[model samples]
Target: MYIRKKKNTSGSISIQIIKKIKGKSKVIESIGCSKDPDKIERLLKKAHKRIKELEPTLFDSVKQEEQKLKFLPISNEQVIPIGDELFFGAIFDRIFNKKTIFQSVYKANDKHELFKALVISRILYPGSKLYLSDYLFYFKKKEISDEAIYRLVDSLYKDEVKQRIEEAVYKDTLAKVGGKIAVCFYDVTTLFFESESEDDLRRIGFSKEGKLARPQIQLGLFTTLQGYPLSYEVYHGKKYEGHTLLEALLNFQKKFKLKNKPIVVADRGMLNDANIAFLENNGYKYILGAKIKMLPSGIKDKIINLTFIDDNVTHEINIHKTITYKQDKQKHSLDISQRLILTYSSQRAKKDKYLREKALDKLKAKIEYSTNLTKNDLKLSHYAKYLDIVDDCKVEFRLNHNKVLQDSKLDGLKGYLTNDTTLSHKDIIEHYQNLWHIEKAFRISKTDLQIRPIHHRLEHRIKAHILISFVAYAIYKEFEIKTREIKKEYQISYKILRDLIKHVFAIKFDDGEIFPIKLSEVQQKFYDALHS
Candidate 1:
């Protein structure tokens, strides 16, 4: 076997171990590929070492076997447990230590180590604080007491740790996206607790997960267009989702002191007169999802009557109105002009029609099966608007054909409200569509990082928990981006990558020397991508 440096079309060098048989060279193994001179030298050294290991001599093999037998016996008691100290732990350390601002925020050695452990554990194996010590000891062989963990959590809540981290993320993300943010996305979700009792911070409110009886906290997150989180705030559980927009945006602007105002894009849940007026009054531009059904009668009629030549076509309407809202029990009014963009999609229309038909079928089935219909029945059904009741000592129900026809007329239609006239209607619609990135961020936090069902009772600890999850998510997103950029040919999902990390472990001998086991082709690709 021989080491060969092959040049590629991209001006990079690939170091591989090759063998010659009958004048044809066969690649035995690929060490690595890189364009940097220092990395190439390193790869060359690795190639030499790999060659020696792969082509061991007879005496070297016997010696190695003897050494293994001497050190590790074939008995269960004598076997040392392999821990995941190489791949999973090392990748996290490399990413966290190099890419994140936590190193600057956390100075003390114990605090830094504990914080690292907490974040890593939260990403790999999310659990309660009591199990963290055990998890570390088993998986990483690092010992950290529960007391130390709680103490770090307490300290994190103080000293403006959360704010500092936010600043760090903002600067990092700002540098990432060409040092400017033209558009941003905002969304809120509920994180419920497992407990029944309510505290000042965690109270019974509208649960997005349908756990209305359980206490929860509202999390408002601001992310870049690509879904990299910038800032977040935890609000009172019962706070109105619409009311959070102004507070969160103002705080984000004040903290970051941004020179350029980024256009905010949100869903219909954040659509309100006060928010629209606030966005316009604060010198900020926005693209908000418009409530087409609630628009003025004239505007609604115009939107409904518009014709679409194709699914990609959109119509724009200029709206001028005065918005009045009460603040501090005083009435205030603001006049604003905005553009409403309406678009049609065949796919959306099909889904909408399917849902409407399904609801009507269910409603009709309920009315047909029941002997007597009460007011409560109609009150609970969302399709109640399409039904009318006549009471004369007995209740008779009739489907409102007019309302059904009106609703069908608006099918396949969607609206977006924007104040930025320079942008095309298509651009506004596209910006609003990117709002799903924030939704995906929330999903990652809740499902992958297990940000909900918080176990901590103390408010500070709860905040600290969220901060840790936020940091973990940042790292996770970085890893995801790197994976895509580095390995364009093969894509790895986070779930599968997580599983591979969990299984990629290392064995430590009695002499305190650790060696990672051989990795499969896929795992090697992931490892290389991570390192790259």
Candidate 2:
């Protein structure tokens, strides 16, 4: 039998095999006219088997003339793990483009290497500088020292290197977003130290994590609307959240040389009269958080009775009223002329009412059945505010229901203040809602990056340590943005991305060649999306 090709009228050729019989060829079999090699080989095997069945003598000659294929033995005894950190490093460098940026800033490549290793390690396995040597072995087995890491942190703390790095990162982000930034989100979070002692910079203060007994340092993070960090600051743990934004705002403004004044957006805890005045005096506009009950009695009454049309509403909240301040007013020693955007959320109200009622029930139960209270119970001034003790034969406690009702007035209400009246109330609310961007940055830093429970003792080391976390966060955000841009349908979050990067280990053999472990479909998507 011999293979043959027949060109049809459609100009597509069909492949076939024919038997040479009676001086005329007869078609023995026809394979589809496709260019697939595997399919052709499979069809060829079928044709040969048919021929062999007809002529067993042909198989003897075919076997004698067949070429032998060689197979190599693979040794599994020399397997080694090489994590996908190389891919992470490659992506980090691709986004940062630190080739010349670092050379110019650090005066040499060693510090640059140390910085790269530290930041990548921070993203991979965030820890103290002492662990730098251990993490470096994952990268290239570079012999980094505790001293090298300390010097790196010291360089960041003493000099203004962190700002330079941030500028580079922020510039890259602006390029990603087409170079227009009119609004920024700001928020403050506390990072606690393990030690009980407090330094000037690390003081005991109100921690968001409720670690007031632990000395914490406050961090004010500034990010764009998409949660990419533009700049960040470290303050004494006890510093006021309201005061932390000014330094970062002014520094970021001057550093970027912004063309338009950015409308600052922050949560309610970061709002105060002095901060509003400072922001206004600097010719900056703001969308600061306001407590509904903290407003003047007149304003509060108007808000409580105001009727809202369903013109502009979101999922959980409704914009009820927009009041622009034409004349300055003074209340609680705060003189401000700003627009107040009132919003009410049914969901928030429900949550607030539920939480308040639950808290009230808990407090009432404790007062009734918690036995005779000790000084610790008295020290909890909030719980003690509603309690009345009877010292007659035995101690009895009662809760003041009026105080509970007084707090119910502002259950589901939130207020935002802005100096820019040109923006509609809807726009103001929209901007303030994105403050979750900064909130998320703080969460990533605290939870994933492990910026808290700081192990450093000296102030410079602490500052340097935080600076490393900042750099790591910038890289993490940029990488995250790229992954989203390329493949949003997969929903590769930070944790999933980290796990993907962590699991793709290169398996090195006893020979010089190295092979990467087999990746699943999800892992392949991550690799392609980033590389793409």
Among these predictions, the greatest lDDT belongs to: 1
Best candidate, TM-score-wise?
1
> Can you write out model 1's per-residue Cα lDDT over 1-532, one digit (the tens) per residue?
9999999999999999999989999999999899999999999999999988889888998989976776555333333333234444564455344434345544566676677778777777776775567667766557766677778898877746666666766776887789999999999999999899998899998889999899999999999998888888889899989999989998989899989999999898999888887788789999988888778779888988899877989899999999998767888999888999999988888888898899999988888888877767668677777887786343466888988888887888999988897998778988999888888898989888888789889998998898888887877776666677544565666667666766665556666666566777777776777666
Q: What TM-scores do the predictions have?
A: 0.78, 0.73
Residue-level lDDT for 226 in candidate 1: 85
CA-lDDT, candidates in order: 0.80, 0.71
TM-score attained by model 1 = 0.78
- Residue 25 error, candidate 1, Å: 22
Off by over 4 Å in 1: 1-107, 361-380, 388-396, 485-496, 503-519
